[model samples]
Target: MPKLSNDKNSVCSLAQKQCCIRSLNSIRCDSGVTSAKAGRSCEGDDGNSCMDDSYQVCCSCCALGLWMRRQGQGCDADLHLGPSCGHVFLTCCEEVEARSQLPLRGQENLKPTVLPRRGNGLCSQRCSTAGGRVLCSCFPGFFLMKDGHTCEGEAQYYVDECAMRKDRCGKDFLCENTPGSFKCIPKQKCLSGFTQDAHGNCVDINECSSLAQPCSSSFACVNTVGSFNCQQKVLVCNRGYHTSPDGASCADVDECQMGSHACGVGQICHNLPGSYRCDCQTGYQFDALRKVCTDVNECWSYPGRLCAQTCENTVGSYLCTCTAGFILASDQKNCEDINECDQKPCSQECVNMHGSYQCYCRQGYYLHEDGLTCEDIDECSQSIGKLCAFQCVNVVGSYLCACPPHGYVMSANGHTCTDVDECKVGSHNCSSEKTCFNLQGGFRCLSFDCPHNYKKVSSTYCERINCAPNSFDCQNSPLRITYYTLSFQSNILTPAQIFRMGPSPVYAGDHVIISITSGNEENYFSTRKLNSFTGAVYIQRKVREPKDFLIEVEMKLLRRGTVTSFLARLYVFFTPSSI
Candidate 1:
């Protein structure tokens, strides 16, 4: 029975005689393998310790008296029943961790030891389907059972650094793999505004404006994804609303009068941030000093362009300029009607009012163009005031009931002064021998008929021919008469003493007839045709010793021809009587 060998020098000389027979039965041999036969097996030895030492050679192998206890052998102190109950006992307990190295049994063919060990004890070690089935040894997250029947230090691998990354767990994990363990468990998310935070890591929960959304009566609640939708954004659905799906619910955005928003038209709507604007119920706004939407420019309450042409800007404000000659109206603000009669501006009749227009002129007229329109101006044609002093007459709109023509009358009210009598109502024919005077505003006709010896001197008097027969004697006999008359009526004398007269004046004894009488029929020639002169009526001849009687008078001067006028009458007749 001792010839058995897995040869390595016969198993190192039978492992030194099986360690000197378990140190002479002081027993302690277990590096695992066993089988039994009335065994006291400190487990480990393939052929089942050589088939239990071949029955210990037929019974000596501790035959029932159980004594193969080696190493300093102190035999049998417990776990009894070792007396061949068909001889099978197995025990193995191991602890070898010193830089670990245990890789033994592999000559291949060994499989049937189907695991079943739960802390069993006994030196009855039959863990042998050929040497690898003696199991028991553990430590770092352990697990070993190839029929080595169980050794488990596991359950400790929750090692979380988000290991192996599969959907990264931890909101209460669920990745469970056991052998060398792996765990995590709880997952199912979906909340923020109702959906889609697709694992960018949980926690987001918006449920769309939250409060479980059933919105609609003027509704609202926008929480997407895991559910909540309903939105009719504004107005009407009072006391706890319940109509949804476009009918409205949750109600209350009316920040103050909102057909939903845009507060403009006497405004008010202020929900804030995610939307809602327009504001003006406290006396209006955005008018930043009349920049628009209005309520304030109080015209600055005091000074400037505020309304002469218009500026009525009020509410919180304004007034003034709504009347004179008017202008303002394009909203420079208020008081309009500026048709100052359509801008023709007006020199006269323009009175349009509201903001202003009144230039005046129509009764018997006055004003032309500059004040604009009511023109009709003829104060008798611009004679304005001197009015007909001499000629003016321009009527239609005014002036001219005339005056000035020697007799001057127009004063009964056609604007003026009177006096045209030429002497008491006979209206002047003057010559039944003179005088008709009524002056100041015209009339004076006077005639005296002082011819024959000329001496009236009253009634517009006359005195010429002072002749008492002083000596213009002519005896040439056609009548033998020698008459010389008194001189007289004279604008100074000699056209032959004016046709040989003595009073109507013309001398030298008359009969020296010289005739070409046309200075307007030259009778006393009406004062030389009233001073526009060139008068001459003549007859000449009286020259016999008067020491100086050169009375030469020949005439005709209209385009001039034949004319003479000489008069040297020094007929003093003698005057040296005394010193």
Candidate 2:
């Protein structure tokens, strides 16, 4: 077999005839003719019938190899000098026959040849055939790269479709981006009780107006963010009714327990079901105008008819009192008289007065100094001769008769006394010539006559005779006669006369001087010359001692050639004063 040319550019630079044949054997053009000349003839020469000329045949196959290269096909032939011209033509003709089986117009270069796929790690899908070569592409949701051979997954983010293509979606719709592409959906699909805002988001629903109201008649509907709720209303109670603790239910109100009643002081309030009443207590009566209880005075109702003597009225009661000499009985309404002499308060006799008593003594006795005791009266000493005859003796409440010492007896009158004549009764002891005399207390009998210097005045009675002249010491004698002796108590209020002494016969030329000679001297007793013949003694001061005072007052008289003197004694008994 002959070898064909392997130089592609040189082979394709030939005429268009027989372009489909490439593989062919080689031949010698008349033993020395060159291969270039043979190639030239095959390019333009048309061969006629020949007696199996190898050079002409070989040149026809060479022209076929160049035509195949010009049609952009590969040639697998070796171009070298050989004696295989018929076998090369047969091989070229077989390839031409295989390509001719396709459609004749657009299928001129088309073939059903198998394409070898490329090994691309970045390809995300299977390989496909295009124009007799393998192409790498992506699966669904992916895209091809710029080199047109590798594939990648689609992008997850959205892109502005309007910015890219202004009319991407129509006016009634909005463009919504998907993972790899975009679509157009309706602008709004809002739910019930909800509305879309300007920015295309669903907000809350106002059930108070737009939808049906869900609250009751006594309740109110409130709207919230995307929801609504119902609230119950506050209920009001009527008069005498109050709301319960839960502020929903109504209950009856008790005015008495709540201290809302109009009861006054001292009035009791009684509670009823829905009202209250007032009542008064005992000893009190209700007053309509004052709405209170008033006290009733029972004492002033019946007056004095309730008591016997005197009636006094008090609050709800009365009192009684009796008159003089009477007392109130235990019944508190009656009076009883009292007996004043009931206890016998007198010693002898008791006489009842109206409200007192009087006491008296018996006939033989008299009321004592205390008036409650009786004592005897000494009648004999009270009246001397009227109570007795000769001598009176006092007895209890009476007098008795008594006799004298010389033998007297009582007369018929119990208080008289009489003397008996001794000679007539023969009770005397006189002789025949001797005379006996009877006296009240005694009787005497004479025996001798009196002397010459004394004369007998009566039997058994004699007195002293006058003194003789010059027979007495008249001037010098210390014994002077006391004419009158006087005794008096020392009770002189002022300078008063206690005693007086004077000469017996006052003469015209007589003069007397008097002086207190004894006693406590002039401290108690004093004297004064009253005239020329008399002298007077007096108390000088108040006597303070309970003793006897013997005051001697001396008087000296100057007479006609004779001086006579006398002394006066004053017995002043200084007894205690009564006051």
Candidate 3:
């Protein structure tokens, strides 16, 4: 066994070599003391020969004690591991001390032999030795690296203390992170219309109460959300004037345009800048006390000088009127005599006088009891001798002689009657197919005709002669042809019945068809059956001018299974409307 010396330098020199030996052997010592025998005591400055197992164990314990002391841990009292240590411990101890004092190096270079039981390891920040392994962690603003032995700065692996609920900021403060640390700042900043209180809260600023004379003398200041408003004051103006929009001035009001003036009838109102004037109309006088316009009576004021005749006074004017037989002249102030004859007041004649008129009658008339009317003399009854050779008639202001109603007319002497030649004068209503013969008081229309294969049987009827059994021409021809004449004025209405053809004595189940066979080229006539036995023809179109139509109406009668046709020669005449 080797003996250890009592000299501090020699002992420390021996402890360094032994510590290295223990480290190489992977041994651990908790109290900086190894579990080995005490080494042999080595004297003097030469302790190199003290290599005993006990001395080596004791020296290793001494070296560890010195290192622990440099790390701010007290060394074992028995080791004397202060500045008095020898060169053996000084070299290794100095090296260990140098490494421990250096700033936090990388994880690979940081190695500590003995660490504290709880939070002590080769870590940049917090450390733990749990389950025989060194684990590292960081503070609120720092983060642990992958090595589990080092902590990264806040800039590299940033940790949001606010988001992670690890900040120490108050409720009114905002937490902001920095390198390896955290900061607290006020949460809100005061803005316009708001002020910050002692507790850092924003409160509304009452500008209306805070400012001096914010509004003018005529306005009232009112505070609003984030602003202020000034409202105008109410004002009253004098009569004939009104307040302006801003309540700062006054403006004039027009009484005439607004119809507010107290001007009476017959007065005109005129407007001034701020007042009105009332004036009287023509022929009216204004009464100042009554404030009204009164009519001027010219008749009483100027009498004869104003009008030539009568004078009258009216509201706002005067009038000049004439007498009963005179009129007002164009000058409106004089009168003139009216020509009464221009009005034709008399039945026969009229004559004008200075201011009146006269009425008279002609030779065949006499003035009535009324001076304006003239009545006939009735010469037909009042005459003393025969005045006419025919009947006498009286008319207005004259007398005349009239002939009989037919076949007679008055001669040129206007008193003798003469026969009228109806045929020569063409006055009879006879068609072209008939002859008109004059008689004593009337005229006669005669028509005589016989168609081919027919012979006259009577004055108006024609009979067919003998024919062969198979002669269709003689058989089909009318067995009897009758003549008819119709007369109408041109003013007759359309659709007039002109002729009716049917059997004289009819039996049952008798039907006839009537049609205008000729002289209806203009389609003016049509036929219709009134009953089974009677058929009639009508003038369907109006004849506006005097005309004649000779239509042959044929009626085919079917009676008792026998068919026989008859012909009627109708002569239609339209005379003048006056006849």
Candidate 4:
């Protein structure tokens, strides 16, 4: 009842004129705000502000707000409706300024414009009647029809697999899925003192099976995912056993008996049962405590027992072994006897005894007379293999193992049988001093000749010739006979005494002892280095050329005794200056 105005379309013709006036005055034209304020704004009323009562104000250009409206376009300018009605197209300058604002509503008769947003696609999800069909809705108080087009008491996820029984659901309600359909599921449990038969009908579980849950302290029972559980209590010994009294109390058990303890080597025993197990004694261990039977090294008591050779712990026990030369003992506590002899006894023989063995030689053989050795003996007469002779010398425990005849003898190195050169292969060699002439069993190299620059003083030695002119004439000199006073001696004595003659170079001379201080004693006789004898003196050696002796004397060599002990070892060396 305030006021009324009309002729809205006619304003389009006036728009250019109104815009020109705005430019001339540098003022703004506001069809929206100015219309709302003046209620009918008259742009050229000079200073008078005017308003039209029949026009609608608009705010945006994006929602088709700039388009003019037709009377039958579901809207009437008489009432002014719809989001986009009659707003002028904003120019570039105005759009730049209005860009910060939200899309504007231009008509009041438009349904309450809900600016849901592009991403949500609100229009697509909203249900509406389409193609002669209406969408379903869960209304406040209506039961539903067979299709989703009607509301029901309650809705449920329907299973399409049982579509055969589409409209009606039976007793049990199972969920199902379908495009615009659902079904009811049934109940499988009862609240009352009710019971269900087979076929998955509601029933009661037998709690009497203890299924509801029942057990003592040493036992356990757990409810299952859908049921219950029951377990037996673990049994234990009363005072000293793994078994209970009435066979019923759970008590501490002594694991030391019943052979339950699988102790290792050097370990004592223990036992357990029922809810029982084994354990090693003091210095041993249960491998995992899981099975007390399995023992391992605690090694606290017997230090070296574990690694005597290398003791390795095993499942039920540890083992004690010996080092290469040692063995496990009977008590199993210490290392004991091992037979090194069984493996190698020096060489030829092996004998094993408690802790050791002794080596011995066999017949036709002799130990080297040294505890460390064994030597072959010669038993030629007893056994041809011993020596190559009819006579066999048995010495000590065995005969000589030698090759003696046929000009051959055992070599100095013992084992080798070497050929005798008659000069080099025999026990005694009469070499250049004697004669190298081959003989029966061996050979003889005997030389009785006087050496150069020396005259034969005795059969075993020579002397330098020096005398007053015409003292005595040798066989090769002038024929003159003369006597000589001789002095000869020997510092050493041999097992066999021999004869010695000296001080005379030829047979034409005779010898005599001037004096003696009991010449019977060996040391007294050789005092002046004078010759003494214990064996009969043979004539001066005269065989061959330049014999060792041509002396004129007589003496004897005792066959029974010889001197051995001596203070100084003297070497009586004589070189022949002439012979």
Candidate 5:
């Protein structure tokens, strides 16, 4: 036998020669070591186990031959035994010594190895004891030991057999793992609208024909790959209809605003759901079943009410016409009154009303009966004494102011009478011998004092009243008489006779009386006294016939009962005019 040393200088050939001498089954481990069989003591050495020259250590007697063969030297190859023969082995001595120092099973130490290895092949986890026997075991993911000492890997780790060798299965099959071998199953997958059968083949599913399909009765289902479609049915609408918002129903179309109505001009279109109507506008009406608009006789509709003057009917409308003096107004329906007075038609004042005008006058004027003309009012005749202070003279529309007979002027307010001073305006008819005196409405005259015997006879002069009866100027010269001969043709157209008789220097007390005598009996001849002291003769006649006449005139003077007589002769002749 050879002994193994821990020296680094040992020769390798020395272990090969000595390791062949011992039998592999003869080695055993002692009790009291963790890798040894419990209750077994070694027969070779105390605490000593087998260690060959190849550095193979054996803590059990059964693995000595198998452990030596694995070193690949010239060792025993005929000792054929299974790992189940219960043995444990190690290659290094240091690992065996370290595991032997652990406390034995059921010892009171806290870090004790409670169950030791059964036959020296160390288990991956622990060993348990039961019924006075020891069995080796691994963790939960591993298996029980076959060698009564050690455990191998788990069996759930499936091997990839196809990856290693592709011919493990046929082309139409899939490879799956079993405990120690693999199986070939056929490959298949169903399409979208199909399902798988028990025979491992894809089959078509009729979604449209099946009762359990997702499509409703109102819809149609379409089949696709692995799916189906639920489509709503289309609804057909009438001529003037369109689809509803839901896209499944129909609704009517309005044609009024859409310009589909057949209404003509002057007509209005009214729309219904499926039809339209034509109607006439205001101020117009449809004729006897006519389609277009026609004129409406408003004048005839309401008799005598359309206009104040004339009402005329036109095409589709009516007109209101006024007479000559009036005009139309703004509102076409109602006839408004025109203001004819806007042009100042009246002479004085104008008033306007419906379709007419009126003329009025001021205070002193009146409206004529013609209703348009104005005339002046005769205020003088109407208001007699009230018009002026004294008298009223009528003018066209007014009255004139007059004063009394004196030299008077009218006042500014023509109704008041006023007085004027004749003395100041030189209007008095007074002589040189008299003095004028102013009085109300007139003037007065006063003569100067005459001589003692002459009494004032007039305002201008005075004559002497004392005279001698027969003196040269006494008795007014006895009423001196004068004679003259006169001739007149029958054609003389004069109606007066001319003769003069007077005595100069006559006294005022003398009296003369003249008369016609003898040839004056026809009364065509006559005489007149020229003054109180003188006499004159005059004759006048219309000599219608051719005749000759002799006339006599007498003059007499009477003073103090003495009479003086005087005679004068007058002759007349007629000459006939040839017819």
Candidate 6:
């Protein structure tokens, strides 16, 4: 490559100008340059000098820098200078007036002169001119080399406009880098049911309104997110034939199969073409108004023909029942008597009757309050009179009359009691000195003796002996003493006169005072004066049990001014009331 001086005057000199013209025929220009006047000298006082207005001067390679200086610009080394003066010039100058007006051709034969830089020619990737200077650039992924003309780097080595803050996207836009370039994308992206507007906003899309006839004529269309749906239409049909689900046609409905008929529990349902019928079961009747089955009461319908004794109604049947004491016969309608005696309901004896039984007791037994068991009859407690003269002993079924162990005997009647003569029968235990006396139910021995001043007058009486004139004992002693015995039952009434005492011969002027002196400690016996001479001894209190008493009765007689006393020894006995 030929070199040019930095001095513009030397680059535009005549010698350098001639030398550029010789080289111009073989050089090529990549860009166009302006023409100048013909026959003009290449020399000028100012540094901005050029050749004449001709094609030779415009196509010359040396006059490239002169034209630039004349155009008030500077030369860059990276620019290409062709051989003809019509190409971009950098160093020499020349002129050809008419040739400058014609279009230049034959650039393949023209030789190109590039400044000393890295690259095959002006640039490896891109080349341009700006501000009167040649610029070399690379694609987005590459960078300019140190030579200022070549591009270096691979596809992976790129400039991130986003990270480097070199993108022209606004706040609403996102910067996306590509292999050799970058793009501005909207940040707000539209979803399935929406679309993006000019302002980059997401707006809803009315698919229902926008789409043409999306649903069939029988269905209504409904819109959804990113989709649509079809719904069935409503329609009415005639009776028994209902409309289909799609509302396109009508079909028959089976009332019996669908359980929609008005048949009762015991009725059966049958389906027809468009209607239904209900039938009653056996022994039942159908009611037209209620459409239900009713049962037939056979007992009420047949009355006496159903049963002999009684009739009862049952569901779909009848029943026959007998009275309390009767049972139904094998014929199921007639009644038969029940034999109550077979059950042995009575403890003693049971007699069967037509419909019941009677209870009877044995000879000595009677019926108890319960009417079933027999109990012993207490004759001893029930008899109003004395059934036995002595003690009546009650046995299981009868009573027995008992006599005293020694002094009484049971009579031949077996219920009467008799007194035994112990003296004559030799059953008494009396000594030789005592006399045996018999009573109703017992016996007692009696003996009387005189005192020293008295003499016995009889077996029961004693008298005092005569006294001398000075005998005081004889004067005061009893003139007579008598012994007596009495017997009675313990049921004897009180205040009974049991004994009486008086002088054997009645005297006109005799007054006696009588008293019981001993053996009356329980106050059971008392003495009373009657007519001043006769006095009686009476039993005052009744004895409820058998007892014996020996009482002494004393009497003082005041007659003719001489006092005389008498004594009576009385024996009283109380026998048992029943014996």
List the global CA lDDT of all models: 0.35, 0.50, 0.60, 0.34, 0.49, 0.62
Q: In terms of TM-score, how similar is model 3 to the real structure?
A: 0.27
Q: Encode model 1's per-residue lDDT on 347-430: one tens digit a residue.
A: 534534323444544334444445454544345466556554345667699766555565555665565445455567676666
> Which candidate tops lDDT?
6
Off by over 4 Å in 4: 1-167, 170-185, 188-239, 242-252, 255-579
Give the top-scoring candidate (TM-score). 6
Candidate 6's TM-score: 0.33
Off by over 4 Å in 2: 1-475, 483-490
What is the Cα-based lDDT of residue 519 in candidate 3? 97
lDDT of 5 by residue, 294-342 (tens): 8688878974566655678877667877554456656644445466777
Clash tally, candidates in order? 83, 16, 14, 64, 5, 28
lDDT string for model 2 (481-546, tens) is 332223232343446555666653344688988987777544876778888877777776776544
Model 5 TM-score is: 0.26
Compared with the true structure, model 4 gives a TM-score of 0.17
Question: How do the predictions measure up, each by TM-score?
Answer: 0.17, 0.19, 0.27, 0.17, 0.26, 0.33
Candidate 1 lDDT (Cα, 0 to 1)? 0.35
Pick out the ten consecutive residues of candidate 1 with the lowest summed lDDT: 570-579
Q: Flag regions of model 6 displaced more than 4 Å.
A: 1-386, 394-398
Per-residue lDDT, model 4, residue 392, is: 46
Structural RMSD, model 3: 34.1
